[model samples]
Every structure is written in C-alpha cells, then in structure tokens.
Target: MVPEPSSEAPAKSFTDIQTRNGSIYTHPGLLSLPPSSGTSSSSGKRHRFSIIVPESVTDQIILKCKAIASGTSVTHVFIAALAMALSELQPPKEESYAVRYVNHSMINLRPYCRAPYNTREHAAAPYHTVSAQALGIDLVVPGPPIDGKDDGQINELSQVATQVRDYFRTVRPTSSQDEQIAVSPLMFKSLTTPPGSDPHIVSDPPFCPAVISSLGNIGSIVSASHGPFELTNVWAASEPIGAGVAIFLGTWNGRIELSGVFDTRYHDSGYIRKFLERMLDSVSGGLDVDNCTAPIRVTPNEEK
Candidate 1:
C-alpha cells in the first residue's frame, strides 16, 4: 500500500510575515492606540516599547538565553539583577565607582516634515536625531523589576530619549516660529503605520556595560545625532551586580556604535568574559551554524 501523502504544507517565507500579524499580539514595545486611560494622547500615537527585557531573567532563564546566543548572534548578559539592586539597596556613605551612564538618540522630525503630526503614515518624513547622556545618580529608591512592577522609576534610563520624542509630538503653530514651522494638521491626521517587518522580530543584541569599547552598541533614535554629528563616546561605570550591559545596535559596519553602561562593582569584566564564553558554547551546542572562534578578521577593538 502506498503511504498517504504528507498533509502539512511548507512554512511560508519571511515575505508572508504580514499574514501572521493578527494572530500575533502587539509588540511589547509599541504602545497600543488610545493609550491607557489618563495616559492617552489626542494624537492617538503610542510608543512601540516602554522598557526592554521582559523582567529579570532568573538563573534558569539565563541558561536558555545562553543556549540561543552561545554560538549565534545572541549574546548572554553577564550581570545579575540582584547585584544591581544590592548596590542601590545598600549605598555606601563615601562615593563609589558603582554607577552607570547611558547616551541615547532622538529624532528631530521638524526638519524632515514641514508639518507637525503623529501618524505612522508619512513614510517620507525625514528624521533628525539628538544624543543625550545621563548618569545614574544616588539610588534614592528601589527600581521596578525588583518588585516586578513596571513604573516611572523603571523609565529613568530612558527619560532623555522620551523627552525628545515628546518634543516632536508637541510641536505647535507659533507666531515667533517661521512659516516653515507652520506644520500642517492634515499631515498629522494622515498618520498611519509604516510598512515593514514587525519591529519586535528584528531583535538587536544588548550592549556590554562594564567595558566601553569603541564598538559597543547603545543609543535610541530620539537621541541619535542628525548630520555630521560627532561620535559621543562614554565609558559606563559598573553596577554592584556585574560588569556587563546590552544594546540593540545598528548594522555592524555602520558609522555609529551603540552602547549601555553598568556599574562595575555590580558587574565586572571577568563576568563578561565568562558570559561570552558560555554564550559561544551554548550556541554551538544548540545550532549547527558555526564556531565563533574563527580567525579574528576583526581586531578586539574592531569587534567592539
């Protein structure tokens, strides 16, 4: 007897991703339209992401992350959340080196769009970016993700970036402003979502916090420079937890590098070394892709 033909069809290529949108819940980053109650906006626009990372990854969870990035594009974060909390939980009377600094970028939509608006539609709306650096000051209070609550405190690292986005959102007609500043309301009303792969899937890796190599990934669109912008390079101090950070970087061969900062006392270079090794081992074990220890085509600095 002949065997029955297989009933399953082949998986669709990436081109078919749009069909899956309805089945997939909204991306974690993008804010839902109508916002949440008092937080709603007249523009009907919201953010794609509020904060990064689901919550603190437990040790077991860390193991799974190691499996993915070990030998693949994924890289494991070496720092532990507990240690980061401890540094803030118990601060020293004297100043300590356990602090983190971050530089973020924002887009100046004014230059690109002659009108003020908030729709995802204007595909041609050019963007001008700005970068701002912030240092973690005294840990006046415990941060969220500690108690497992997402709140304003959790957003401190991103305050500067958010402010920049708001700046573009609220640009209004003013007498002092030139006719060039007189944006069109129709442009704003026509705002619609852009066409592309879902922002959620094209995940970028996080930055390594403790050591600031020239190539480390960091920055947000709201804070990124617009033109012949000078590169802003800043070293992040470690947190009490570990010496590592994470970033969602642009192309590896691009003009800019993004990075995140961590307090070394919380995270250390040694932890990063171990994390990187484990990551390589984990990826090799799971995927039949490659061994990352190829001849270093790029020098250590270049890898950064």
Candidate 2:
C-alpha cells in the first residue's frame, strides 16, 4: 500500500542546505544577459548534443573515487567533471580570481516513496507525486595556469568528485520537509522572476550557471515491456532557466548518455559544442588542462 506523505521537517533547517555566497559562483555571462532577454520567449530556445560513456569507464571512475566506493553513485563523478570543465570554460574575473560555479542536480525520490508507490507501476503512473527534487552544490576550483601534469589533473578530479559525494551525503534532503523546501512554490516563482526585480528572490538566488540531472539505469525496467524490443540510446533536453545551461544524463544498457541545453542568445552553437567536448574529455581523463583554450570555429565551407 502507498504510504501518506510525511509532515515532519528534517533535522536541519532548510536554509542551511544552500552554500554560502553561492550566487557569486554563477557564470557572469549567464547573468549578464539583457533584462529583456531574460524572458522565457528569448531564453526558451535550446540546443542538445549527446555522447556515450562505456560501462567500463564508469566502473573505473567509481573504483578510483573513494567517495563513490563508499556509497554514492557515478552521478557524482559526472557532476564533478562538469564543474571542472565549466570552470575552465568560464574563467574567473581578473580581480577576484575565483572559479566559483554553482550547479544543481535533480535527485530521484522514488526510493523515498513508501510501499507500492515505489513499484514500477506507480512510478510510471501518469500522475506520480513530486518524485524528484533539485539539490544545489557549488564548486570552487583554482583558476587556470596551474600545473598541467597528468597526475595533478587526476588528483584534482578525484578531489572534486570526493567533495561532490560528501555534499550529497550531508547537505542533500533527509526528510519530507527538505523535499518540500526544494519544490516550494516560492522557489518556482522566484525562478520565473527576473533577478533583482524581486528583492526577496534576489536575496535568495534561484538560478545557477548550470543544472545537472541523471535518470540513472533504466534498461531493465524498459526491457520489461510487453513486446520484444531493444533500447539502443536515450537522451533528454530542457530549456535553460535564466540563460543558464541544463545537462541531462541517463544510463541504459551499460552506456551513459549526456545531453545539454543552452540559450543561443547567451551562447552560440560552437561554444555549446566545445563545452560538451571539454566535459566529456574531463570525464574520460583526456582533457589537457593547459590546452583548454577556446575552440576554433570552422564553417562548412572552411572545413573543405
């Protein structure tokens, strides 16, 4: 039987979940868009791309990261890699020298659901309860010109992954109140309002530079369908909120797929493409920290 939703609050205060000074980390480019451009009509456009991560690679990363080995899933590793890549893509201000980037990940709450509600039938139901919540995490890494040694890069990635895992374990929601806080109507209203217009929302930052969400492994569940069919690939995309970027990931049949959404008004196709490439490179342990200069654009005619 499905259980009633809990009315109890979490042990910790909801406000405590946010990272102090998180707004400072948001990419300046995203926030700098003209006020008029912040409208949904302007920022609603989205561009998407996908890449596959072999199961072996995912397993290796999990083994190497002690945090993941302890309990967390591979999603933490991807978030860390993405944070690092974005820090590289968007350099810090010359004066501050802070490579602060804030991102939120959507956590699946099906496991938290009680009894029959946790079953596939209920989860797949057209009108399931709010089975997901967005949890925020901020990444602050050293600005560029650091040593590009292979060992250094690996160590950095590992450290970031560890931080992500720790944050998820501690700061993320632990009770129904936490979930309620995450999906609050106020938060939704804040996101729709332009920054600074609403003093309340401005004081509490609603958007970040990027948002990452993972659908996890769904091959088994999908394969359980009535007919005989194979799910070869899966991808997802959503309009960026407030000129920011949205990254969606899903693992199916031992392969992980990544898709990104961005606003053309704030970013071009080439820029978005290069960013994804760098993110994939970071995850695959092929990114050269020293050579992450801006990507060169080549038109179709120029390709010849």
Candidate 3:
C-alpha cells in the first residue's frame, strides 16, 4: 500500500468544521459555477485535467518531505502542496484562523481481506480526516525567511504535511476498519441507488474537501510492453461529489501523473483547471535540493 487514509471524521467535528471553512474563503468566486444539470460522477457531468510532474521536482519534493520526518511520504508532499495552492490562490480573511479542510482518501482492503475477497477491487472504504490548521493564512504569508530565502514556506509546508503523515501513521488495523471494508459493497450500492430524494452515505460529505487518492507507482503494477501490446499512456479519474473535486494521482515511468475531476454542477472546467494549475505550480518549483535542511524547505522557483 503506497498510502491509505485514516478513519472517517466524527459528525461532531464536522459541525465544528463547517463554521470555519478555509477553502470557501480562499476562493469564494470559484464556487459560483455555471448552472449545470450533472450532479454526480455517474451523471456524465465531470470535467478533468491532468498533470505530469518532472521527475526531478517529484524527487525534490519527496526528499524535502522526508526531511520533515523519517516517516513522511509522497502523499504528505502532495498534501502540503495542496495546502499551499489553496492558500496562494487567495489571501485569507481576518477570521481565516478558523478555516479548516478535510482530506478524503479511500482504503484499499485487499491486503486485509481473505483470498476469496482479496481480489475485489471495490473492497475499499472512504476516509475523511479533517485538519485543524489547513491552508492557514499564517502558514505562508507574512512569514519569516530562512537562510535569506523563503524557506519559511517550506518549513510551514513540511509542518502541514507531517501532521497528515503522523495522523495516518497512528492508525492501525482494527475491527472497525475490517467492518468498513466488509460493508464497502453496500456503500457502493448506496451511491448508485439512492434511498430517496436524499441519499444515505456511509459518512457525511467532507468540508472544504480535498479528495486525494494515490494509485501508488503504476509502473510497479503495469508494464510498457505486455505480450503484443505497448502501453503508451494511462488515464484515470474519480469525479467529485457534493461540493468539492477529486484528484487521482499515480507515479509512472519516473513522472508523477495526476488527474483531477469535479462535477459541473459544483465547478467549471476553468475553475478545476485553475485549481490544478495552482496545485502543480506549487509542486513544479525549481529549488536546490542541497539548500534544504531538516527544518527548512527550498523555496519555489518563482520566489527565488
């Protein structure tokens, strides 16, 4: 498993989260999308965009993240980059300190289930974990510089990313996790077949959601030439539900490829494009890997 998400957030915490939605404040205009009929991914109303991060940049980000903590992984790098993008797109409001964001990642249960059920691909459960200081205004703007460079942002990014890493690291295999995997099929059925005007979900929709799912290193599972076929490219996406977008990422052939999709009802293609652009922009930095310290991160190329 490259990385899987933690348990779903509690409803009590969710109530507190809505009161402080950072994503909404960061880009209020983005939510005012064009009128759309499509409501879900299955409704044929999803827009998409893809990103292929340079291998060098990917390695740099990964290394910098590891400096934050020995346990930090690629997923944490993305999470930090995501927090940066959300913050950079718009300045935070005066009350931005209350803003929050939720990360929704699915848990692949094949490793936990028995041989007969292990083969099931949909044997996964959704996990929504909220952060206390997501996209915090103080994380970036008006921050001190490190070594005459904006390494302050780097340190901040690492802090944000490491928090997520630590949260997941604390999770262990539990009976609840096993139960969620077992009932995943019923959850899937609920998605396709709504109970009524309001569909019942296994968990509440995430607040200021950043739904990220990593397919890990696809190169490990897929080969370029299999039998008589040559694989040139592979594309995949899981469309957004509710009000946020979903990002599906995988590393292939030394490059980290990412695809993000959102329902038109909640977003415009341009909005999604801009959102992803900001995200990749945060990742595609030209920083000296050598300049980075365990407590400091290299600044983005534009900043330098």
lDDT for each residue of candidate 3 in 1-304, tens digit (9 for 90 to 100): 2122254433334444435544535642231112223434433355666666666666776666567688887776676667666655444443332223444335544555444444535444323222322233234342344466653333255667777776555332354344344344433443465447542121333233556777778888778898999986665665455556677777777767766776554555556655665656555442234321222211111100
Q: Which 10 consecutive positions of candidate 1 have the poorest summed lDDT?
A: 45-54
The candidate maximizing TM-score is 2
The residue ranges of model 2 lying beyond 4 angstroms of the native Cα positions read 1-12, 15-44, 54-59, 62-69, 92-96, 111-119, 123-155, 171-208, 224-228, 286-304
Candidate 1: segments with Cα more than 4 A from true spot: 1-244, 247-250, 254-260, 296-304
Question: Tens-digit lDDT track for model 2 on 75-145?
Answer: 77778777777666544542223344454444445554555665666755322222122333344434334
What is candidate 1's lDDT per residue for 59-135, written digit by digit as tens? 23334434443221222121222123223333333223333322222324444343443334566555432311212
Ordering by TM-score: 2, 3, 1
User: Candidate 3's error at 124, in angstroms?
Assistant: 11
Name the TM-score of candidate 1: 0.23
TM-score for all predictions?
Answer: 0.23, 0.62, 0.60
RMSD of each: 21.4, 7.9, 10.1
